[model samples]
Target: MTTIATPTTLYDPPPSFALVSPFLYRSSVPTSSHLPYLVPLHLKTLLSLGPELPSKALQQWCELQNVRLVHLGRKRDVVGEASTWKPVQEELVKEGLQVLLSRENAPCLVVDPSGVHEVGILIGCLRKLQRWTLSAIFAEYASLAGSQSRDIEEQFIELFDTDLVVIPPLENRIDGVRDVVNDPPLLAPPQ
Candidate 1:
């Protein structure tokens, strides 16, 4: 049986610009590189950091929220107002969101994760239009919990570059990210 924690049941951390609410930060990654926490990422928005474009909207959002994007690739040419925070497009592709922009050889910023099913459909359609390689499971939760939440969170210290936080619902705050990912896959069936 899956125990789903309702929105009302979440532990509301004291307000510290850290007690992230759902309505705030779209791709709400934490500023601090703290351990033992959950970090919620808006998979779709993350996809936006792509082939490269004027990331004014994305940059402004990060700056205002005081969050940092952990770049996974070597830095590239950062022209204009957007600061290139390194690249994680490779990881995104690995997660199964076929980056067509990379294939088209065009510079675009296309980021949106409606759902795994939705992403799958997108990938399937893209396959028809171009020669695209299959990606790994794309839109799964990046959880930081276990039978002992703290132990699981501790284990992720090296994996996650930011303070892991949860944002509930599809609202994309700290709540949704941790709320479902705290244990196993939130919607997975039982043994």
Candidate 2:
């Protein structure tokens, strides 16, 4: 249920995976002046590495060089509108994450397919996630999600297998596709 707002820098995947540069590695981008490298021009990035690595630095370098990185979210919308991602999610369940590159939110999204899906019931999750280095996150918001939310979450998991990490987006608003998630429980996940 977590939603993220980030600096607008995104990375676009190219046609060939072999030809793509290592995300942390530097390569020149052609422009009016000679720049040794630029941040990725796409929206999402999935990495074998954790978020604490030098990705923020790399993004900044790109900005300095006049490259803009539009952030594709792990928790943000694919497009400004909520409608674009419904079919995409179904395709994601069928094909896994490789299909993310071709979506309307291209150049801004990335994901790791390895062990990305897991679910287990844990009561005190904030401490657990904070202390443990898990690939994904999950938790309940206080007494657990309401019946409607629980059902919606089950539907989501049926469509896509993934670990449940509850960040509690907001409470009671009807958006499409993931409208269920936008309205968090009356209680947010507490510390």
Candidate 3:
């Protein structure tokens, strides 16, 4: 009797993993098991958010994989106060956006511990910068974040100023960057 060989699956994506665009992905903090799933992404950079530094093992993994690891988290001034946890800073989000926009950082992953609020907020702002309507933005956020979504985060996205997000020159940016830069949203003249 002849036996056939079976193929095994290798990819096991981290919790809440989703593609933000052709090159950008968002997910929760990847554990050791999830690391293998990341191999196929060929990520050039991993942008971590939240108030905690990445685990040493994760840093080592990034180094071994030849991926640049960037952490944009800062400890809270008033610790131990859950209510005092502030929203991700606008400036910080803008800086993260700049990183994602760069062609050099293509195929990047943005991760936070829960992969809900901070990542949601960043993506929401990006949608605004990309000229998405507020309803559509909230719908996407709600879908990804589920019940974990916060009104404050939604408020932040509503109030975010897209004009303040500085875009790199066309040549330095990823291919889709020009879609937002070349076409300005139409505005009705002041009555």
RMSD of each: 19.0, 18.9, 4.8
Off by over 4 Å in 2: 1-17, 20-49, 53-56, 65-99, 102-191
**Per-residue accuracy of model 3 over 91-126 as CA lDDT, tens digit each:** 668878888888999889999999998889988988
Error of 3 at 102 (Å): 1.1
Query: Each model's TM-score?
Result: 0.21, 0.20, 0.84
Q: How accurate locally is residue 70 in candidate 1, as Cα lDDT from 0 to 100?
A: 29
Q: Which pairs of residues collide in model 3? A: none
lDDT-superior candidate, 1 or 2:
2
lDDT of 2 by residue, 59-108 (tens): 56555644334322332233444564332233223222222212332332
TM-score: model 1 vs. ground truth: 0.21
Which of candidates 2 and 3 is the stronger one according to TM-score? 3
Order by TM-score, highest first: 3, 1, 2
RMSD of model 3, in Å? 4.8
Ranking by lDDT: 3, 2, 1
What TM-score does model 3 achieve against the real structure? 0.84
lDDT of 1 by residue, 111-179 (tens): 222222222232332332232222321111222111212322222222332222222233322222233
